[model samples]
Target chain A: MADTVATPKAHGHVEHHDVDYLHDGSLLSWLTTVDHKKLGVMYLWSVLFMFFLGGVFALLVRLELFAPGKQFMDAETYNKVFTLHGAIMVFLFIIPSIPAALGNFVLPIMLGAKDVAFPRLNLASFWIYVVGALIAVTAMVTGGVDTGWTFYTPYSTTTDGSVALMTFAAFVLGFSSILTGVNFIATVHKLRAPGMGWFRMPLFIWGMYSTAIIQVLATPVLAITLLLLIMERTFGVGVFDPKLGGDPVLFQHFFWFYSHPAVYIMILPGMAIISEVVPTMSQKTFFGYKATAFSSVAIAIVSFVVWGHHMFTSGQSQLAGAIFSFLTFLVGIPSAIKVFNWITTMYKGSISLQAPMLYALMFLILFGIGGLTGLFLGAMSVDIHLHDTYFVVAHFHYVMMGSTAIAFLAGLHYWWPKMFGRMYNESAARVSAVLVFIGFNTTFLPQFLLGSRGMPRRYYNYLPEFQFLHQVSTVGSWILGLGFVIMAGYLFASLRKKMDAPANPWHGRSLEWQIPSPPITHNFHEVPVVTTEPYDYYRPFEPSVKGHH
Target chain B: MWLFLATEILMFGGLFVGYGLMQSVYPEAWIAGHHHLDRIMGAINTVFLLCSSFTMVMAVHYASTNNKGKTIMNLLLTLGFAGGFLVIKYFEYAHKFHDGLLPGRFFSYHGGGPAEQAMFFGFYFCMTGLHGIHVLIGMILISWITLRTMKGEFSSAYYTPVDLVGLYWHLVDLIWIYLFPLLYLVN
Candidate 1:
């Protein structure tokens, strides 16, 4: 690719660090690295490790739930399995997957900045997350938490397991989350390139900017909540312990206040990826660019109010419930607008079916269902019936797993070449995308029916009536696992191949793609003076292309 | 720095929300609980924290002006004020513990409605205890900045960390500003 030879500096593509980011390839470098790209890669690997670890726990959950009478593990082990699964997935994987991992890698380049405003703090955030994960592992080894990831009181307080360590782990992780948020916010505010005005930036920046706001503002609430919960369990503080006159329901309000906005925290970055992918794959500029950008901020603001909807069936006031239900509907508008905009961008454009495009399309369908189902739960009366059922489980899985996890995968596939300077098997990627979509639907879609048909979540055993759906869902989990295994195979296989990746493999209009496949240590030779809008596809993207993507 | 402070406010903001809800639920219990706290000591600690904030502001001011000597002096004053605040907190917690106002199941008070009183005391200890932890963290931060100031690492052209740390210290004081009223006083 000629772009690789369009040397911004005197050196051509021969500089090893220019095409790949392994640096000196020493343990010391990995340990003490402050480069945002290195930190982002570290975050990426750790989150993936956690994802598979959590996936194993999920498989065990599905295996146990395969038959109504408990196939293998006892009820106690079952409880611990599901709890560990939830805690691991939430804290270790999905929460940090997009924003901390992909955002850290791409946000700087997207804005044409050399690095985030606080590079040292970026390094510290990664270490803090590691420390927090270590604490959680210690808790697991000691006596794994079984109070559900929500850690609702009385059960959480009275549990003999390692609630204190686990909650403290979460509290520590909250600090990591906040530090990243603070760093991102500062970077967006102070580190944009000379000519990169706010609107001139890509949609991914807007999504990340909004996510950073929520991460900074909302994550701390979770920190304090967990701290109080930890204090409650360890010192027998009566805050969430009702036997000592504390309201457990009050704990619900506090938890969801953070956790709900946290839902957006999980999804918005995924939305950002979709926003980026649609423009590049469709070969068109973004539709409703301003609305799409502002919608992220709008979603962030509205997310806080809808948290009360999570507490609707938990003995909140009637007036409060009605208001929450109303506000919950309001939060959907921004998401609906984003979906509409993505489709509109694809409307008359020369859309191509690429690997990343396939995942983006899948995300559109899956996330649409996820958001629409949220409306069902948002309705007060419907939520009352489905509150603790598998329905709620399925609903959130649609949002969390179906959307966020899938989006993370999408972003991973989309940027894998740029990050590694290697291209995976395109056909294999497309097949994996299909398997993932089908397998995911097969796994979660049945659970929704089981939920509606009166299957309670967190059940160690169930009646024979719910067995068929459970079996179907269990089969779906295997297919889903197979999809991931195939994905891992091709991704790893791509690493060993000799074929080098083109810098602009996807013809992406973003700054990250315009540079070398794997960008240099400092992203640009000079901080790029941005003179064009992102996804300026109206301009001839490649007037002299060697070959089309 | 402002973004970080916003997080801190939201963090303590959550705790205050919890405190507010619990207080409203058990008004008489909260009323009964606040009495056990040493109001005069609380007032004094508040003054100490306020003075610390002022000193921190002065440290930033001096650092911005590139006056390393005055910056160090004001930082020392801020640390001294934080120390004074901790000393009063020590005595206050000591009095409560001495009077058997410990947390949860450890509460040995002979008062009626032990559960309700424990609930209030629970919030009291949690709120003040969390605040106390922040003060300790703030002191450590201040000491670090003090050493940095003495080492002449900061100047007018670049005092971002000093200015940021000052923002953090003010947030601590601001949280205490609310914590004092909510935990130490009631009509």
Candidate 2:
């Protein structure tokens, strides 16, 4: 078989090929771009900015907790910092980072489609995220939301801060999530290349598809929840307030109904990236590809039923608690299945210790710890003891920040060449990858210990007994922050001082490698005919148009 | 569009679950509150919505069959039904306001325990008000399609936008079908 792809002979190729998507940069062109790549890169930068912004708040929180006796800020300021940190990270950074940013760039191209089915909607979703984020910032500026990210009722309603404004911001952000989910679902359904069938699609698409399902299905609950919360705060609706004959616990139900599935929304895409990175680096067909792909859906489906597990300690019925606890365990099964399959895929396979691969490996270990810890918290009896503890906090940060956000970084490093048409310093990438791992584990591992020892989460001041662990955690945050800073420096340096990257720099058998680096305005010159399996390592999958250069 | 509807279903699902849970918790309060709602107006609104849905379906059919004039007319008729539903809603709300049946803390109806009464009205107003917002959104979308239809943008080959909008309007109708019995005739 010819290693080179059939050169697309520019058959009425009306588009100008002289300029890459990056060089044709004008503010208006960037803003009005319906091009998936440009929109994707923009999502990348915008979301990364949000990630660091959240990081800053996180550092402040850690600094405040460095010695436990309110280092500099007051208790109220501490509340605002952690709330904004959590809200900004979850809504603005983690949820949209991988799927909207990296997935937007890679998904269409990997499918060999010209663009997503709803390109306009993709752009609109990004802009909606921006507007929603800005509104949240406005809420923060107006007074700062003190209800924490969960915004539990009664307290949330009575709070003096900009609760209504913040909840409304979250409400608006739900539209962005829903729109993106809708777009991805439509694209995956309608826009696959001629030969790409369901199983032939990338696992990332599977992760994204399942994620989109959860996003569209679950996000609206959050929207309605926030709206009701706003109503409760602004107009004194009694649904969540006990004084009005409403149940405060019911608010927890509405919240976790969306939020628990929202956990899958945050992690699924990261798993998707790992599915890609693991296979590419290992040079193997993913071990149990069907199982791995199906697991994403399984995780999504199981995610909904497990919402009650979060409410176990909130005075929910014991029967409901036992049922939810069991469901939560079921959710872990699929996640465990994915982790097992990834490891199995790597078994006896040719391995490349690339920056992306390192991150994938980290995700494997970190997500494992996160998932296993979930089992501890899922056991109703055990959860009662660990409930609202730093252990729970550490568990989620490990899953969300460790697994999803790490996978985001991996995908970013993996796809950077194709996105920017340039190569980053691999050694610096490797160094920071390890730095992030050390930093992340250091920051959260102590929290788990502190949690087991009865250190509560979101506590402004701690007794001297827990001071050592808190101090260790605080110092770890600095390392994590430094790791991220190093990443920023290297990635920015790649934008200027680097050689142009080849399309298939990693030599993986995927459709994205079949396109030009920093792909043209249109991803493909013609719709590709994808005959081979998605991961056929025996033959190098050539670019659809080998003669583009 | 179907997926977006899935989200809408869940959004309404939250409110419905809240209503169900609260109703189960305070059955007497819910029953007493339900009696205060005008079943006649609720029925009228339901009729108006059902008729609008039929007209909306007809418009989609006409647009698909390339009957632009009939499509525009049906759309306008559907819009009329939508507007009529809103007008009736306005009356119902005005009547509630006059009776001091406001939601939450402003709820002044003291016959069936103010707190429980307020909770009932809260769900009623929140659910209906939210649905009303949906109705308004459906109207805006339908009117947009109407103008586009007038300018000849759709035909049998490309009536997807019309079909999608029809689906949304149908969801609105469907939600009211549930709301009518739940809020008005809570037997």
Candidate 3:
């Protein structure tokens, strides 16, 4: 059956049908937009700005670690800086990066629908994110939180510097995450094109669907956890406080229960981006589509049980620790399945080393180190040694930054032309990609050794022997920073150019590529009926709508 | 709507788990704390919520059957029951405040059981307070749907708002079913 989604009525004044979402409205129109693409653009810019802020805090943390013993800031200031970095990066940037910014723009267009099932809710989620982010930044600027992002109890309860406000900020952000999850679940279930069955959809949608499940399910626990934390601090609620006859370790249990799954919330979307990029770059159908697709769901399920692995050294029971360790290992299987499928898919196909592909390839290498190192830490005996060391620090950055951030860049580059209708200088982007991969590894690889050598994290000073590795990591951070600068320069420069991209860049087979570059406000004028799978490269490409090549 | 409710369950589920854990840790305090909470008031509030949930279901049924008058009437009844529940809740809170049966450092009752009772009171206020807030929000939503029903905005074919609000009202009632036994009656 043919599907026809009525083009969204014009915002106010009637205009020609040819106007794209970008030009369809004034600046005022954007603030009041219910259009999914416009809201996505707004989210994109907001998250990008947060990325810049988080990156600056990361650099400051690195800069202070350059020589150790107060290179620029003292212990108190350093603690606040690092806490802000983790809080900003995790809450303000990474969680929303793919799902809110990119997913908002692409999910509906890919589903071949007019908009998300709840466009008004989508807009509300974006504004709530903004309000939450502003509150967090305000907390940062005014005295800042030193409890770190975890906000573990007792310490979080006693700490003096706006911890309540920051936790409140996180609580509000959790609501935004939950709303987006609700919107996406409804959209995916109810809004798919008439012919787009569950398995027939793109793997990226699978990854997103899995991530949304965790977001809806896990994030609420975080919301309650944070709210309880605020109460514990403000009202002496005595739930998580040890002095008040409460268990501090219970805070860890509560925090990690949501947080472990939250790491999946961060990584799954990144993996979703890789699933799209690897197949497209290979110019072949995904090698193990069903395996790859199912693995996303599998990972989401396993993530919930593995929160205990994070608390192995926090005085949890031996049996609980053992079970958590075993469950933690379970995460590796699905992750490896995905890694193997991406490799196999690219094994014999014609591969293009474009900027997006380069980032995808980098994700494979970085995530490999990131995912494997997790097993070492998952083993109770080993984690006992490396509990709070730089090793744990290095491991997460590999996953969060090296893998997720790199894949986000890959997706941004891959869809850049489509989103904005202008192509960046490919050679420049390639050079930046190389620098990023090199810089990212250089920054974190040494920390693995520092952590193994017992250089504890969150320390203001360190032994002289650890100094060399710390400096090395610091220099690596500069290289990473420079790579990102060059990327920003070229990407914004592309915006100056006119719309020069065709409907399908990279000859992608996804429904998103079937539409015009800088897709119209309503996406497809008429819904594209899907008959072939999203990555069916072996079959001749079918133009689902008229006026295509 | 079910997906949204799943989030709500998880949110409240965290609190329930925390309460159970803290209860195990301070059983005497939890047991003593229950003595202070008036069971009759708790039972009455529970009945109010149960009746409100029934009215909410009837409202949805009427909306689907195109009985606009009955839908509006049932919704108003649900709102009244919900408001009654909160009014009873206010009296319970005010009595606790008068006796200085507050959470944490504010526990100042002239007759005491255990110091850990402070933590019990903390969880008591938190759990019931959160539930009370949900009750308040439910009233507002019922009012919104009630107004819309009066405006002839819903009928047999389109009563999604009425239906979703009914689901929400049921969840609120369901949580109270758990809270009543755990807080007011459990030994």
lDDT of 1: 0.86
Residues B1-187, candidate 3: write the lDDT tens digits. Answer: 9999999999999999999998888889899999999999999988998998998999899999999999999999999998898888999999999999999888888796888888888889989999988988888899999999999999899998899889999999999999999999979
Error of 1 at A64 (Å): 1.4
TM-score of chain B of each: 0.95, 0.97, 0.98
Question: Each prediction's DockQ?
Answer: 0.79, 0.86, 0.86
lDDT of each: 0.86, 0.87, 0.89
| Candidate 2, lDDT over the whole model | 0.87
Better of 1 and 3 by TM-score: 3
**Best model number under TM-score:** 3
> Chain A TM-score per candidate?
0.95, 0.96, 0.96
lDDT of 2 at A281: 86
Q: Write the per-residue lDDT of candidate 2 for residues B1-187, one digit (tens) a residue.
A: 7788888899899899989999999998888888889999999999999999999999999999999999999999999999999999999999999888988889886565535878788889999999999999999999999999999999899999999999999999999999999999987
* Per-residue accuracy of model 2 over A1-549 as CA lDDT, tens digit each: 012112223331224544667777787789988988888889988898998899999999999998858679999999999999999999899988988899899998888888999899988988988899889999999999877899988899998989898888888888999998898889999998888899999899999999999999999889888888888886787888988778899999999999988988999999999999998888888888899889999888888888998887898898989898887777777888888899998987888888889999999999999989998898878888999999999999999999999999889989998888777777788889888999999999999999999988889988899989988898999999998899999899989864457666677767777666777777777677778778777576544444453
Docking class of 2: high
lDDT of 1 by residue, A109-209 (tens): 88878889999999999999999999999999999889999998878888788989999999989899999989988899898877788898899999999
How does each model score on TM-score?
0.95, 0.96, 0.97
Superposed model 3: Cα runs more than 4 Å off:
A1-17
**What TM-score does model 3 achieve against the real structure?**
0.97
Q: List the candidate 1 regions with Cα displacement exceeding 4 Å.
A: A1-19, A541-549, B111-115
DockQ leader: 2
